[model samples]
Target: MSCPRTKPAWSSLLGNSRLTTIPIICFGHLSIMVQVGDEIPSISLCEENPSDYVDLKKELAEGNGLIIGVPAAFSPTCSDTHIPDYISSPSLSSAGKVFVVSVNDAFVMRAWGKSLDKEKKSGIRFLGDATGAFTKALSVDFDATSALGNVRSKRYAIKTVNGKVSGVFIEPDNTGLDVSAAQKILA
Candidate 1:
């Protein structure tokens, strides 16, 4: 695929001193965001530690599962609202193997997970996309450099059955606390 050279947009909000929007420059391929019926990507994500890797392709292929993608590990909305809903949702038990992924290192993810579920009662596993390969493969990544320091996954809830996407709930605002909320998906 040939990438088109598009001009960057300058914003008056910054006195037009710098480009506000960065054009998408594809090197050899264009990534289309994941859609329904898409199979889970065979990417290895970090689990608790850098050396501990977990691949969901095989696990998700066998049963129902939920993958919750967040922008950061301990951000305000993510820590206070988003993940707590899933952790406390009664219906989440039936959702099968629930995994929460973030574009953070394994240590941060592990610490955040423990802080939320001290007793590990949630049964939700926290995984790290340290290099964001998993998020990029899913095409759910967004440039969050302004707020979160780097590219991050948009808030999303993906339901999987037999390793194929059954439902996808992505927040329209990228980092909003709606649509992908547990109340909506778990119901």
Candidate 2:
């Protein structure tokens, strides 16, 4: 026979009353913590290209690029808020291009893209953060050691020119304000 689920002990402690939990702790919603006007570090990202990956030094040459860093692909926050804003925003117009990055594998990133909008391909390129070597170099990696495995990147976006960051938008809270949704920057 299948085992039945047990009631959570915390709720039972409420004496059958549905007591609303109060905020006892103020969580740390750190900003990009990494600043803007800082020189962007060059890092390799995997493209759909046959060579499996592209060189960051070569790809970031001659134009501006919007590099978006997400904590993980397919997570509720990232899916519902982050990447969708970038794909839907008209203001993300730049002389260069836009790329969405996460520490997931290439396949997961691709699947996330298709779920976001398969019809609108090419507007946003999904890059794989398979090893997170690149994310670490940018100083955005946070020790999500509790739930999310090893170190992970915090959410943020940067506009880079010739590999130097000119503009940045990092979420104060991990729930809202995706970088591509920055109308002023886009304008």
Candidate 3:
């Protein structure tokens, strides 16, 4: 029998690492084959911006898209290193549509988006995969019950062009890494 008060996936990822204070946390190794030629997921979700809800097909159709998956928002790696790098790095411009995806509510995503220095948000958009629908499609969703209370997605990044994944960077240890850092991808 499953416990009614089970652990949550969010709590763990947000709490697992040691990046609580830093503004730009960067992870190192990733091992996943979300390589080029793979079609990105066709999913839709509400954006923090009331007027900017995202319809994956429409958004991905526009141009190259950067889809970032995180265990949870505000987690050490996510807040301190992972996201800050992408939002601030000038090289990130190459990926046309930059989005941060987490299994959090719209409000949380919005707050997190706003927390970043205003300048960092210039080229990035924070999106809520609140329902985990998109995460399930990607096959990265995991049972993060110890802290997050339910299933959640892993920390990862993928680049898509014309709706097909061209590059995928997934943390091998499933912790923190710069799988899709602008400096590495841009060069």
Candidate 4:
């Protein structure tokens, strides 16, 4: 006599191949990095305009915002292509407050900002997360010792509504633009 087969139990898909019955949040086929409904952590960032520090939580609370994370400021991909998308997009004005964040100092970010938005027409803010505190808080910071050296933020974008995360598009490889492009976010 054999027992009847029970329904297959789903489990949390942690990074490891090993699976367990433990339940956890997930995004598509991978384990969760950051997901909808999570509150954006309170952190301070250096802003280029007026050259002062601003609290992310306070800024995000005023309205919807887009946070764009790049590995570094002035990197080839970031400078030439990635950020320029957001800078040149006509839809950016309607995307609420947009911020380009990098793990570099304010001086570097300010210079890069000038290079991209020469007249500051886009209204997109370039912010410096020099200490990596804000990036780490989002759980998107990665170690790129081979190419970039030290810990750096994964290329990603987050859409926040009143300080709570409503949507997140994170690159699987930490450097690709497949999911985190401005066009995709505006869509």
Clashes of each: 0, 0, 17, 0
Tens-digit per-residue lDDT, 1-187, candidate 4: 1233432254334544555444444343222467899888788889764359978788888688999999988998898888998888878877798899988888889999999999999988899988888888888988887887778999999999988888899998899887998788877
Q: Which candidate should be chosen as best, given lDDT against the real structure?
A: 1
Question: Pairing residues by index, what is the TM-score of model 2?
Answer: 0.70
Q: What is the TM-score of each predicted model, taking all chains together?
A: 0.85, 0.70, 0.74, 0.79
Rank all candidate structures by their TM-score, best first, as comma-separated numbers.
1, 4, 3, 2
> Distance (Å) between predicted and true CA of 19, model 2?
43
RMSD (Cα, Å) for all candidates, in order, is: 5.7, 9.7, 13.1, 9.3
Residue 102 of model 1 has an lDDT of 96
Give residue 141's lDDT in candidate 1 (0 to 100). Answer: 91
What is the alpha-carbon RMSD of candidate 3 to the true structure?
13.1
* Residue pairs that clash (backbone atoms under 3 angstroms), model 2: none
The stretch of ten residues in a row with the least summed lDDT in candidate 4 is 1-10
- Predicted structure 3: lDDT: 0.75
What lDDT is reached at residue 155 by model 2?
A: 82
Better of 2 and 4 by lDDT: 4
Predictions in order: lDDT: 0.91, 0.69, 0.75, 0.83
At residue 164, what lDDT does model 1 achieve? 95
| Candidate 4 TM-score, true structure as reference | 0.79
